[model samples]
Target: MKIFGLTGWSGSGKTTLAVKLLPALIGRGLRVSTIKHAHKGFDIDHPGKDSHNHRMAGATEVLVSSPKRWALMHELRDEPEPTLEELVRKLQPVDLLLIEGFKRDRHPKLEVWRPSVGKPLIAAEDPTVVAIASDGPVPDARVPVFHIDDAEAMAAFVVEFCGLRA
Candidate 1:
């Protein structure tokens, strides 16, 4: 699958952009998947849910399924975090894979920037950054720059970057 990354400082709208981009890409008939990286402890299970009870009962992996959707939750018992490549291998095949983090990975990426954050732009330092989506105009850069509010345009850019026919 083609991999595209979204990276930015905290509260820089990466999640917001990702959420917007998915449906737009899907609207264009592309099968898209997402990989979100979280540094802190994260859980998909909910309290008082059967899946949560299963995990609490020492089940390492719990898969919950319904007619419409399914989820596989795995516990990394004393293991190191999996890399982006490994994580991608586990995902269902798609026309594109939109990664929400893993900025350090060697893949084509877009930087979601917000001037309010006052954080340095990663594109300024990372060559893998092919574009910037910001609420404000971005400084001159080698790659295309876009406005954060325009999801359709950003989705189009991502599709072109992946060499997909609209």
Candidate 2:
């Protein structure tokens, strides 16, 4: 799959941009999948659910299935966190893979920035950040800057940048 990324600091609207970009890419007839990285502990299971119970009982991997969907939850009990590429290998192929929040990964990324967040731009230090999407003008950024609300234009830029048609 073609890999691209969206990275930014906390409260910079990376998740919001990812959600907007999803439909824009899908509307263009591309099969797009996303991987969202969380910096903290997260739980997809409820305390009383069988899957949760299984996990609490020390099951390493718990797969919960129903008619509409299936989810596989793997416990990284003692293993080191997997690399982005390692995670990619586990997914089915797609036209695009939108990775959110792996700011340190070397893959090309669009830095989502909000000046109000008061964080420095990652693109300034990371050459892997190919573009910036900001809530305000970033005149000095070396890469192309897009208005955060302009998902269609950003989608076009991503499609061409990744050579999706090629």
Candidate 3:
């Protein structure tokens, strides 16, 4: 699958942009999947859920399936966190994969920036950042800039950057 990324500091609206961009890409008849990197530990299954119980009962992997959907939860146990490439390989093929975070990985990315966040631009140090989406002008940006609210434009950029056809 063609891969692209959105990276930014905390509270810079990367998730918001990604959420908007999904439908824009889907509206163009493209199949898209997303992978988000969370800095803190997260859980999808709650304590009372059967899947959660199975996992807690020493199941290495627990897969829950229904008519509508299925999800596989794998326990890392002693295994280290998988790399981006390893995680990507586990996904079913799609026209595009939009990754959020993983800024250190060498993939084409758009930096979601907001001056109000009081953080410096990541594009300055990351060559893989091909563009910036910001609420205000990025005067010193070496790459192209887009308004943060322009999901259509950003989606189009992603399609073009990944060479994905509608």
Candidate 4:
């Protein structure tokens, strides 16, 4: 899959932009998938759920399935965290793969920036950051800048950046 990433410090609206971009790209007739990286421990399964119970009972992997969807939860137990490349290989093919977080990974990314966040721009140091989407002026930035709310323009840039047909 052609991959792109949305990255920023906390409260920079990365998730919000990702949500907006998904439908915009889909509207343009492109198949899209997303991978989100969390810094802390997180759980998609809750207590008392069958899948949760199975995982708690020492099953290395628990797969929950239904007519609409299925999810596989693999317990890392003693294994190292999977690399970005390893995780990407597990996904089915798609026209675009929008990654949220994973800022340290060496992939093309857009930095979601907000001046109100009081954080310095990441693109200044990270060569992987190809562009910036911000609410305020990024006068010092060398890369392209787009208004944070301009999903159409951002989607168009992403399509061309990934060399996607639509």
Candidate 5:
């Protein structure tokens, strides 16, 4: 599967744009999958649940299955965080893979920029940034710039850049 990424400083609308792009891409008949990296510890398991109990009892990996879906939660208790590539291999193939975060990884990414955040622009130094979605005019941007609210345009850019077919 082809890969593209959405990245930006916190509060810069990366998730918002991803939410908009999902249906846009899917409407074109593409099967889409997403991988998101969380900077802080987050848990999908709830206390009192069997799966949760298994994890708390020091199971390194817990696989919960049902008629509808199966979820595998791997606990890296003392292991290093897996690289982006490592995580990608765990995902089932799809027409497109949209990754959020892992900004330091070498992948084509669209930077969602908001000047008001008062943070330095990541695209300024990251050559992997193929395009930018900004809240305002960015005449100095090194790559194509689209209005942050223009989900259709951004989605089109991604499909073209990744050479994706519907």
Candidate 6:
């Protein structure tokens, strides 16, 4: 599967773009999946839940299932962190995979930039950044740029970049 990343400063609207792009990609008959990275501790399991108890009891991984949904949680447990490539390998095959973080990974990326955040631009330093989607006018770039609200254009960029049938 081809992989691409969407990255930006906090509140720069990466998730918003991702949310918009997924449906468009799916409409083009592509199977897509996403990997979102979180820096802070997060728990899908709630307190007083049986799955939470199982996890606290040293279970390395837990799969909770119901007719409607399923979730798999794996404990890192001090292990060396998995790289983006390794993580992608664990995912089922798809036409494209959109990764939200792992900004340092060498795969091609589309940066979501908002000048209001006053955050430095990563594309200026990273060759993996193939393009940018900006909430405001993007500075002159060596790669293509798209307005953040143009989900169709962004989706097309991704499809072409990946050489996917679209």
**Segments of candidate 4 deviating more than 4 angstroms:** none
- The residue-by-residue lDDT of candidate 6 on 42-120, one tens digit each, is 8889979999999999999999999998999999999977888788888889889999988887889999999998998
Pairs that collide in candidate 2 are: none
Give the residue spans of candidate 6 off by over 4 A.
none
Error of 2 at 119 (Å): 0.7
My TM-score estimates for the predictions, one after another, are 0.95, 0.97, 0.98, 0.98, 0.96, 0.96
- How many angstroms is residue 50 displaced in model 3 relative to the true structure, after the best TM-score fit? 1.0
The predicted structure with the larger TM-score, 1 or 5, is: 5
Q: Give one digit per residue, the lDDT tens place, for model 4 in 81-119.
A: 999999999999999999999999999999999999999
The predicted structure with the larger TM-score, 1 or 3, is 3
The positional error of residue 145 in candidate 5, measured at the CA in angstroms, is: 0.9
lDDT for 92 (candidate 2): 96
lDDT by residue for model 1 over 1-166, one digit each (tens)? 7999999998998898999999999999999889999979998789999999999999989999999999999999888999888999998899999999898999999999988999988999999999999888777667888888899998998898899865
Window of ten residues with lowest summed lDDT in model 5 = 133-142
Could you arrange the candidates by lDDT from highest to lowest? 4, 3, 2, 5, 1, 6
Backbone clash count for every predicted candidate, in the order shown? 0, 0, 0, 0, 0, 0
**Model 4, CA-based lDDT:** 0.95
Model 3 / residue 82 / CA error / Å: 0.3
Q: Comparing 2 and 4 by lDDT, which wins?
A: 4
Q: Which residue runs of candidate 1 sit more than 4 Å off their true CA positions?
A: none
lDDT string, candidate 3, 58-111, tens digits: 999999999999999999998999999999999999999999999899999999
Candidate 5 residue lDDT tens string, 1-166: 9999999999898899999999989988889999998999999999999999999999999999999999999999989999999999999999999999999999999999998987888998999999999988775788999998888888888888888886
Scored by CA lDDT, what does every candidate get? 0.90, 0.94, 0.95, 0.95, 0.92, 0.89
